[model samples]
Target chain A: MPDFDFHVSAFAWVPETSRGWVKCLRPRWAFEEAGFAYRTTRLGPGEGGSDGYRAWQPFGMVPAYDDGRVRLFESGAILLRIGALSDRLRGWDDAEEATIASWVFAALNTFETHTSRLTDGLPGAVEAVSRRLEALEAALGDREWLVERFSVADIAMATVLREIGETAVLRRHAGVSAYLARCLARPAFDRALQAQFADFDDSRVA
Target chain B: MPDFDFHVSAFAWVPETSRGWVKCLRPRWAFEEAGFAYRTTRLGPGEGGSDGYRAWQPFGMVPAYDDGRVRLFESGAILLRIGALSDRLRGWDDAEEATIASWVFAALNTFETHTSRLTDGLPGAVEAVSRRLEALEAALGDREWLVERFSVADIAMATVLREIGETAVLRRHAGVSAYLARCLARPAFDRALQAQFADFDDSRVA
Candidate 1:
C-alpha cells in the first residue's frame, strides 16, 4: 500500500475518560476506513492552544492534516479532503459528494451540538436532539448506511452519535440507536477507537 | 446571465430585527458573490419543522438548497459547493480550497457558536469569543484576507463576525473588527443583505 503523505495531529495527553471520544478520531477513522495509509503527530498536553498549534489550527483545535502540501484543520474539512481522494468515501459524483459533506457539517453543527447539550443535561437538550434524530431515523428507515454505501458522511455523523451511546436520549429512539450500533459495528470504527486508546497510553495496542 | 434553477429556503416571515441576518443570507451572499443566478423558496413562519422541510434539511434548518441534482442543508456545505463553481470564491487551488473550506467550518462550528452565546448574554461568552478572535486576529495580522486572496473563507468568517458587529468583544479586537469590515464592504454582501431585507416586513428594511 502506498503511504498517503497525510500527517495529522492529536492531543498528546488525552485523559482515559475522553481519550476514546476526542474529535481527532474522526480523521483517523476516515483514513482507516478508506484504507488510506496515514500517520499523526501528538502535540504536547494542552499544547493545542499554543501559537505554534494555532498556525495550523486557527481556533487551536485538533486533527489538522498536511497531505505533503496543504496543512488544514477542522475534522470536517480534513475528512472531506480525504473523501475526495477515495471513491468510496468520496461518493458517486459532485452532487453526491457535496450531500455527503453536508452531513459531516450536520454532525458538527447540529447533531453533536444537541448531543453535547443533552450530555450536559442542559435544558431542552433532549427535545432538540430528538427532533434531529427523528429526521435522521426517518431518513434511515432500515437503510444499511447513509448513502449508497458507507461513506465519509457516516464516519462524521456516527462518531457524533457514538458519543450518545446507550445514553438516555439515545435509548429513547430504537431506530437511531440501531443505526448507531450498525455504524459502531464497523471494524474501521473499532480500529479507530483502539488507535485512539493506544494513543492515550503506550501500553495499549490498537 | 442565465437563471441557475437553484431553489433555496428561508423564513417566510423574519421579524424586523433579524430580517437580513437570517442564516439564509450565507447562501444568498455566496450565490451573489459568485455571481450565480438562483432563486429561493420561503417556508411559512415556523414551518421549518415540517416533514417536507425536514426532507431536505434533517434538522429542519433554513437555507436548504435543491439544485436539480443534490438537495442539502448546512450553509458551510452550500457555500463550499458554490465556491467550487466560482474561481474567486473557491480560492486558488486544491490546498487553498481546503483551507478556505476549513475556515467555513470554523465559522459555523466555532465562531458562530460563541457569537450566539454572546448574543444570549451567556456567562463568559466574551472571553470565549475573544480567545477565538485572538487566534483569528493573529492569522489575519498584516493581511487583507484569511487566505492569500479573498475566498469563501472570508465570506463565512465575515458573516459570522458581522453578527457581533462593532460590539463588546469585537470592539476590543480592532484588527479582527477591521477584517470583518473589509468582507462586508463587498457589493455582493450589500446586495444579498438588501435581498434578505426585501423578504421581510415593511417595518424593517435591514
Candidate 2:
C-alpha cells in the first residue's frame, strides 16, 4: 500500500496518561508486524462522535481503517484483517484461525472486563479481578504465547494485560508478568508505541 | 457434520431467567441462519472450569464450538466463523464485510457494555446507559438493520439488546425495540431460542 493509500483514524490528541496505550496502537502494531504500510487520519476524541467520524465508526471511537479494498472500525477486526494480509503473524488453517480469534475475544471481553476493577478499591471487584488473573496465569503455564506462536491472539491479549501493567494483582503473578514483558519487548510493539507518542507530540506542536 | 461431529458446550442447566437467552444462542442463531448442522454438549456452568472444558475454553464459558475443521469460543468469534460458512448471513465484498464487522464489535463491546447498568439503578450508570442507547437510536435511523442486510451483526447485537428487553432506556427507542422484535421474529432466532430452552428443560429432567 502507498503512503496515505490506506487511512486509519487515530486520536489527534490523547490525554497524557493514556498516550502510548490508546486503542489505536493495536492496529498500528498489526500493521507493523505484518509490514503493511498505512497512514493515520487524526481526529479529536470528542470529534470521534461527530457524524463524519461515525460514518466510519458508529460508536464514535477511533482506529477505523479504510483503503480502496476495505473499511473497518473495530481494532480487533482491523487487526484480524491485517493478519490476513501476511502469513507471518497468523495460522493459515481454519481451526488455527478460530483458535486465534477465540483468544482475541477472550482478551477483549473477559480479561479486559476485569481490568476495570483492579483499581476500583472494592473488595468484590478486587476478588473478581484476582480470580480472572489466576485463571490467566494457569492458562499461560510454561507457554511463551497463548497459541503455538506469537499471533493476533498475542497482540490482542497482551494489549489487555499491558493495561494492568505492574498493578497490585498483576504483580503477584510472576509468570503473567514475564509473559507481558515478552509481548511488550517485541519490536513491532515498540514501534507502534513510539509512533503513538510521537503522533501525540506532533499534534500538540501543531 | 455427522451426529456429534460438531460440539457446542452449553449449560447443563441455565437459570430460568437466562435459559432461552444464554450466550450459546448467538452461535445457535448463527448456525441456524447459515443452515449448518451442529450438536450441543452439556456441562454445568461451574463444570465449565474442569480440565476438559478449560482445554477448549480457557474461561470455562458456555458456547464453545468444535467441528473437525474448526473449534471456536467467544460467541462473537463463533458467529463470525459461521458467517464465513455461507454468505447467507453476511456481506459478499470486503468493504461490506468490514461494515458488518464494525457493527458486531459495537454491539458486543460498546452497546453491550452499557446494558450492564440498565438495571443497576445507580444514577450515574443509568445516565451512561441512556446516553449509549441514544447513540444507538441515532445510528439506527430508519434502517431495518445495522447494514443494508440482516447479518451476524444483527445476531450479535439483537442478542445483546434482548438481554435488556423492555428496560427503561429501551422503551424510549421504539426503533431499537422494534428492531429487536424484527430480529426475534426471524425463524432462525426462534429455532435457536427454542432449542436452547429445550436443552435446559432436558437437562432439568435428566
Candidate 3:
C-alpha cells in the first residue's frame, strides 16, 4: 500500500464530465491492480464551492488530486504520476515511455480539444468533431489499442471519447466505438463508473 | 550529457510577437540551461506551410521536439519532460513539484487560452484577453515568481505572456509588464531568443 488517498474535485455534469470521471476512475483501477489500499474523496457542487476550489485550483477546475505527499491538479499530470508508481501503465523502455506520454497528450490536447469544442456549442462544432473522429478512427485502423496494450493513454482517451460516444457523430466510427466498449468492459472501469455516476446523481438530487 | 540533441520546429520572432513565439522560446531556454545542443527548424507562413518545415511535425505546429530518443509534440508536455530531467525545476520536494505542475496547466489551459483568444483577432478578443491579463497580474502580484523560486512554470508562462505583452492591451497591466521584463533579463532567455531569431532576416530575404 502506498499510504496515500486521492481526493478529486469535480462536478457530475459539465463539458469536462468525461475527464472528471476518468480522473476518479483510472487511479482507483491502477491502485487496485497493484493491490494498494486507497480511498477517494469526491467534492460536491456546493461543498467545495467555486471560490474554494479555485483557490486550490486557480483554473477553477475539477479532478484535482491530493496524494499523501503531493497535491496535483491536472488530470494528465495525475495520470502520469499514477503511471509512474506501477509498471502496468508505463513502458519498460525510454522510447516506449516517451511514446506513451505523447499519446497521452494527443488524447487530451489534440483530440479532446477538438472534441470538446464540438460539444461546447461552437459553430460547426459537430462537423469539426466528426472529422476529428474520422481521423482518430484512421489512426486506430487495425489496432486493438493505441500503444503496446491497454495503457493509461487508452484509459485517458476512452474517457474523453465517452462524452461524444452518445452522439450520432461517433456512431459511424466503428473502431473507436469498439475500443471504447473494450475499455468500459473492464470490471474496474465499470465499478468506477457506477460509483462516479451514483455520486453524480446524488449531487443533482441534493 | 543526456546523450540527446533537441530539434525544435518553430518560427523566429520576439517573445511578445505571438503565442507560437512565446511557446517556442521558453523550452529553448530550458534546453540551453541544460547545456544541450539544439537546432531550430523554422516553418514558413501558411495554414500549415511555414518555410517548408511542415514535414517535421505531424500536426504542423510550432515547437515540436525531436530528441535522439523520440519525437515529442505539444509545448506543455515538452516543458514537463525537460523540467523532469533536473532537480532544479522540480522544486524542493514532491509537494512543490505538484504545485508547480498544476500552475503550468493553469498557465497554458486557462490563462493562455484567454490570451490566445484575445490575440485571435476576434471582436472583444482584446478586452477578453485584457481581463485575463489583469487576473494574471493579480495572481502574480508582489511574487518574485510563481513558485518557491523561478521554475518551469514561470518560464512557460513568461513565454506565453510575452505574446500578450506585445499588445497594447496587455501592456497596460503594470505587474505583468514588469514580470516580463524580469524574465527577459535571464541570460538563458536571451540566448534562446537570439537562437530563434538568428535566421529570421535571412529567411525573409530568401
In candidate 2, what are the lDDT values of residues B32-148, reduced to their tens digit? 888888789988556888987888887787789987678888888887877766668868777778887777777776666557545444335567666777777788899998778
Residue lDDT tens for model 1, B44-121: 755787777777887677889877767778888888877887866777777787789888888888787678667766
If chain B of candidate 3 is superposed on the true chain B, what is its TM-score? 0.77
* Candidate 1 structure lDDT: 0.81
Per-candidate local distance difference test: 0.81, 0.79, 0.67
Against the true structure, candidate 3 reaches a TM-score of: 0.77
Model 1, position A172, has a per-residue lDDT of 81
Clashing pairs in 2: none
The window of 10 residues in a row where model 2 chain A has the poorest summed lDDT is: A116-125
- Which ranges of candidate 2 are over 4 A from the true structure? A1-4, A119-123, A201-206, B1-4, B44-46, B121-123, B201-206
lDDT of 3 by residue, A16-89 (tens): 33534545665555554444555555555555445556556554455677767788876776777777666666
DockQ of each: 0.65, 0.68, 0.38
* Tens-digit lDDT track of model 2 for A1-206: 45336668888886678798789999989888888887898885478878988777776777889866888887778878777766788786777788888888777766665575454343355676677778778888898988777898899988988877868778888888898999999999999998887777444545
